[model samples]
Target: MVKYADDFKAMVVQEYLRGTIGYKVLAEKHGIKSKNQIVDWVNAYKKFGIEGLFRKRRHEVYSVQFKLDVLSFMKRTGASHAETALHFGLTNPSMIGDWKKKFLEGGAEALDYPKGRPVMSDKAKNVKKNQKPTQQDEMTCEQKLEQENELLRLEVEYLKKLRAFQMDPEGYLEKHKQRYHSNSKKNSD
Candidate 1:
């Protein structure tokens, strides 16, 4: 799956809003792999309020209404799963699918509201205000950790390839050695 930044989505959304480019053209121009992405962004903005379109909220889980509206809009718009995924600022289409199924099964209320974090006492808040992360802060930290893990995994794979080549230094050197030997043989001949 192609992962895109929020700015890219916003840019495509803006271009779309201006009526300058069609979905196909915009997808081609902006490197948007999915045509539904363009449609999703515009439709998402139209479907839900601001939250539906933005990617800044990485910690707080969205309300059930938010998910319902997004899925409902995607269904209404005839956008693909990829577009709906992008619309929700989520990278996973399965999540969109799951929500849609829930909504379908349980009506609009299928998206269940999370049980909120426990309330901290005034003294605890005072201490938390001074130092330490809250549940929300921890959630964001976990998101960051996941993002970093993805980057590290890619980097590790790249490095493993490098190490594989490095481990057989003679394999790389063999090519040059063979070329040199061929040149010397020709010279001698």
Candidate 2:
């Protein structure tokens, strides 16, 4: 069924190239289920070029390759359920979960499709790798307080210096005052 869809998708794209008016008429003429299906093919062709219409089936799931492929498709493809269904020759996209289960239960070899259709990951893999830390990650109260205390200490040091400077130019410059006078007098000389 998936293989059939790939052929059909190629057919649709070919007919579309023959021209839009004739394409719609031929679709209506041929009793194609949904005119939108052809339209989707055309759009996909425009976006991905000819090869986008090809179907892919996994021979095995959970292979580093399979995980990488699935994850990549999920992350980068952003395709709709209809596309996924049409893609795997699946009647429904939910079967992807079946594939996942098979993958988990058996590994890559579990990725068997009905008939002899090969599993599709293209060149990419769909592995679920570790994710980068997010703000949601837990932090200990001690760690949190340590950070705050460090920040507060720095702030206090800054404020203390600011206050001393604000209080009197004399103390702030006591050492510099003599030096300042001497430098000015030396300059005049």
Could you say which candidate leads in lDDT?
1
Model 2 TM-score relative to the real fold? 0.32
lDDT of 1: 0.60
Q: Candidate 2's residue-wise lDDT over 1-189, tens digit each?
A: 323467767876787787756556756865776676667667667755666565544332222333323422343346665564344333334445665576567544444334355455744333313455566677889889996676566445545544665576447546434643453234223
Measured by C-alpha RMSD in angstroms, how accurate is candidate 1? 22.6
How many Å off is the CA of 46 in candidate 1? 2.3
- How well does model 2 score by local distance difference test? 0.52
Worst 10 residues of 2 by lDDT: 59-68
Instruction: Kindly report which residue stretches of model 1 are placed more than 4 angstroms away from their true locations once superposed.
Output: 49-51, 61-94, 98-189
Q: Per-prediction TM-score, please? A: 0.37, 0.32
